[model samples]
Structure formats: structure tokens, C-alpha cells
Target: MLDRKTFAEININNYIHNINFIKNKTKTEVIPVLKADAYGHGATQLAKVVENIGIKLIAVAFLGEGINIKKNGVNIETLVFNYATPKSIKENIDGYIYTIGSLEQLTELINFFGKNIKKIKFHLNINTGMNRMGIDIYNLDKIISLIKEYNINIHGAYSHFATADNLDDFIKEQYNNFISAIKYIEDSNINIPVKHICNSAASLFFPEYSLDYVRPGIATYGMQPSDIKIEKELKPVLTWKSTVARVGLLKKGESVSYGRTYFAKETIPTATIPVGYADGYFRQLSNKGYVLIQGKRCNIIGRVCMDQFVVETTQLNNVKLGEEVILIGKQKDNIISAENLASLAGTINYDITSKITKRVPRIYIEEE
Candidate 1:
């Protein structure tokens, strides 16, 4: 048994099931995006699971993440979605793919690599509508020109959908724009080996846009994009658990935690858990969130501290120290999913899970 007081149990079998389910549903290859350490689910461990499943590609948000995973032995085709620093661009990128969103970035790489540099694979990021990264659709001429001048290999081109989860019109517009970008690349006689755009939501809802590959981020972790009903089934893989540390009696008129945010209406029994915002438990969920203790939902009753929070266990009988507390997972018939926490925190499931700090150990449950 693990010695940690608070830990997240990661079910690797469920992860494999989700990926295989996705492949079966879409009939398209998947490039698991491990950005933000697989959204705080530990990217390196998940990467190994993905590798063992024979996935050819893995994507990360930045070069450093890709480099770290590579150094840790994730040697499959890793793609860095963000550009690297000029000094470190050539280091640790032997077989890695990089994203080039602008002509200037493309030019920078060409100037640094020079004409005699080895062929480095890169993907063109077309700005369909997100407007965060990617070259403007109108700048295809410049993109084509850069492709001609550089000796880099064009692996693929991709665009992100800003509203693929909800807005149908906007998603279609982005898809059309991506199609136009692809047409321009083809007209320029450029050979892009793989073309992709579908994220988790898009792949599940709009399979038409699942071009050559799909990069599933949150859905790969068994989460839906929104609260809407999903046709495909995906099982959650993470279960955050903590042990009760202390128990106390809160008398009426006495408050709990900082600022006296929670005042007991009457004498009540309370329990403390060794987890707080510092452990990625959101402070916003101070009063709104509830945890499952002894298969009963215990309401959090205080301002969430950096390392501790109190929960009202008055409704439970004989609550004791070292009992299992389910923070974000199913407890008997009830569940406290990331979606549930995110809803209370006024954020998405991605933020809920990714914000979980590394102080809490992640216990991998690998079932053969």
C-alpha cells in the first residue's frame, strides 16, 4: 500500500479502453495530446501507456514538455505544438515535429537551420477562427513561399476549432476555412503526410472533420467537453482520494477556517482532510464542493486553506480518522467527477484536473 495521505489513483486500463473506444468509433488514428502533463494526470506515465498501445504520435504544448518526455524514454514521434527558443531549437529534437504558425516563425527556423540543415519535420498551423495561434488563412501565399524556401519536411497541417463543442455554425466555418487552407497547400504542390483538426468534441460529435488524425485531449482522460449528452462511452480514469486527518466539534456561533466564512448554525461534528488549493483542490469550491466520506456526501464547511479544509461530518455516524475520502471519483453510488468540481468552480473539467498540483502523489493502477 502507498504511504501517501493524499493520492490520485490512475487506472491505466480505463485509459487504454478510452483510446481503443475512440479508435473504434471514429475509424481514424489518434494523436494523444499530453499537454499540461496530460492535463495533470502525469504525462510521462500516460505516455508509456500510449506507447505500449502502439500509438505513433504524441503531442505536447511546448518543446520543454516534449524534451522532458523524450529524456524520460518516450521515443515515439513527439510533436511540439509551440515553437522553441532559438538557442534550444536544435537540441533534443532529433525526431520531433514542431509547429510553424506564422511566416516569420518559418523564416526564423530557415535562417537558423540554414540551407544545408537536415530535414526537420514541421506542421503548418492554420488560424481558422480561434485566433490564438496559427497563420491567417489569407497568408497561404507566404506559407507556400516559406515551404518552398525551407528544406524542412511538411508532416501535416492543422487548425483548432474554437466552438466545436457547442457552436455548429462556427465549427462548420472553421472546417471550411481549414479545407481552403488544405486546398491552398495542395495547389502549391506541397505534400503534407497527415492532416488533422478534430479535437475530442469534434471527433465525437462531428466525425466529418476527423481528417487524417484526431488529437483527443480531455476526452482521452474520460471526460466530455461539456455537460451535453455524448453518444460515445468513455470511462473516467482518475480517482482522487485522501485520508481523514482530524475530527472536531464545531459549536454554534463558532466559525471555521479563515475570515469565518462558515459559521456552524448548531453544534456539529467536522472532519479535516489534508488537501487544499495547494494540492489542486480549488479554493472556489470551498463552500460549493462536497466529498464522499464513508459513502456519504460531506459538505465542505470553511474557507479552503493552502493545505487543509474542513468538512461537515455531522450527518455521518462514528466518522473516524484514516477513513477514505473521495474528492473526485465515484464513492459507492455517488461520484465527484472533475466535471462536478469544475461546475462548482465556474470552470471546465480541463482546469479542474490540470490545476491539481503535483504535491499529491499519483498512484498508477495497471491491470494486466
Candidate 2:
């Protein structure tokens, strides 16, 4: 039923499996992060799936994303991780939990909502060590003072771990800092019902810090957070695929694609797939990437173009037009993962999948 020559297949079963696996492993509430269109796997659809599975909350990076989820009729509580202006927050206040990281943002909320500020729900973001966002640990007293002054309704308090994947001492330091912030708030008679700091890596590797909730982003989408391996099984939820649009024989010394960076070493079969940098396939993968065709690995031959690229298909018995190609998935006994593409592109797995542009149709598949 797929009409597109190239598309990303979202395996719903695998996604559910990952959610269950993470929840079972951590034994805590899992707050699936659906930001960046659920890492380019299509957020609206995934949000619906998450709700159907009884997940009470999901998180996104922006207010607009949370609004989009609400507009789609997904009733789950959405937590917006990024700061929003007072005007923007007022306009889209329903069904969204905002992260209050700074005194300025908190003041804006108080000023905008006035007495009704108590109706607004939010979580306090504590800056343990990331230093990217959130209230500084030293300044927690000021934040607590303001919260007490306004009688703010803080639903939870959380922090982010910068090196959960690496499993360093810094993680413990960050956790300690988070715990201290929570204690400071509680000492001021402020009740923080839910507390969390573990991301995907920490959720799997450091269950002790799973606290009350785990905000898993990449790992929920079935991608490993880092190079370190975990014993738990997490199936990849996406498979990018395309079809060979053209096939031809390249003679020795003949080059392919832009920049002529690749010249045929000898006579070989070449295939052009309708995928390129514009489609989220990185140009850095120029000559280093490989695609699976007929269960064989076909080496990319030249500079990846904006709309198309050539691959040496000499390993196949016969290269045919419209033959299926696996861009990121299993073929026969071999598999090409997003991690593999990320390695070739000199990036991480998260970048590889999230960069897959919107042009590629996301075809959702669930086994019955």
C-alpha cells in the first residue's frame, strides 16, 4: 500500500516492546519523550499508541509540540521541557505541564496567571550539572521563596544527567545535587510529589536513580543511547527502505555522482536509489555508507546528491530496477542499523534517525 519509492517503516510492535521493556526493567513510571516528532518517527501516531498502552504522561521539547498533541485529541498529560513566553503559555495552557527552570520563567508565569497561577501545573528543573537549563542548585532557596510567595502548584521536580551513558562519578554527583534540591524544596513545606532525573541511559544502567519517573527519549524508540551495550532486548522500531530507480554498468575509471569522488575500480553494476542528503541521509556518508540489496551490502560510490545517490551493486547476482533496498534494517543474514549509519556519518544514533526528514513517509506497521 506504500506509494512512496522511499519511506521509513515504523514497527509499532517493536515500539510497544521497548516501552514495556524499559518500564519492567526500571520498575518506575516511564515518561516517553515525544519531541522532534518522536525523533522523526511521527509523534501524533506514537502519542496515540502511548496513551492506548496506559502511559499517563509524555514529554516534548516545546509548547507547540504539546499543543499539537492536544489538538490531535490525545488526552495524556504532556510536559513541555523548553521555556515558553508568558503570552505563549497563556494561549496554550490546557493539558500541558511546563518545566520551570529559571526564576524569570517562573516570574513570567506568576505575572501572566496572577491568582490563577495555582491552577497552572509545572515541574521544577534543577540544574544538577548539565548547566544547559534549569535553576541552579545554589539558587534553589530563591526559587523556593517565590514558590511559597505565589503558592505555585509544582507537580514534580526533575533534573537531567549528562553522562548516564558513560556511567561516571559525575552522574552520582548530579543525583546528589538533585536530591539536595528536592530536600531544600521539601524543607520549605513545598511538596514535590514526583521526582525524576534518569534519562534513557540512566534508566537502564542506573535504576537506583529512576526516582519516581524516567523520561526516556531515544531508548523508547528502540535506539541505544550510547555505544555501551545493555543486556535487555530493545528492538529497533524503524526501518528505512527504498527502491532502485536505475541500474547500469560502470566501466573502469568511470565516476558516479557529484564531485566525481568515486571511480569504478573495474567493471561493476551500479544502482541509483531515490535517497539523498535532502532526504535525511547525510552527505557525510558519501563514499562510506552501504545499503543492503538482495541480502548483499552495496557500497556507496560517490558524493551523495541532494535527491539521489549511486551504490555499487556488484555483489548482487543481477541488479534490477525497482528492487528493494534496505537503508536501515535487516536483510537476509545482515542488518544495517541507524547506529551503523551514524558511525559512517561521524555522528550518533540519535542524530541519524532524527535527521530523517519529513519528506519520507512514515508507514506504521503493527503485527496482529
Instruction: Say which candidate scores most in lDDT.
Output: 2
Model 2, 78-122: lDDT tens per residue?
999998887887777778888999888787788778878887898
Q: What are the per-residue Cα lDDT tens digits for candidate 1 across 1-368?
A: 35547998899998988888778778999999999999989999999999998999999999888888888987888888987865576766586888888878877877888863336778889999999999987778877876777656888989999987884689999999889889878888988889999898888888777888999898889988757756448889899999889989999999999988889899999999989999899999988899999889999998889999999998899988998999999888988888889999999998988988888889899753
TM-score of candidate 2 on Cα atoms, chains taken together: 0.98
Cα-based TM-score, every candidate: 0.97, 0.98
Superposed by TM-score, candidate 2 places the C-alpha of residue 106 at a distance from the truth, in angstroms, of 1.4
lDDT of 2 at 337: 89
Question: Candidate 1, which ten residues in sequence have the lowest lDDT sum?
Answer: 113-122
Q: Each prediction's Cα RMSD?
A: 1.5, 1.3
Error of 1 at 236 (Å): 0.6
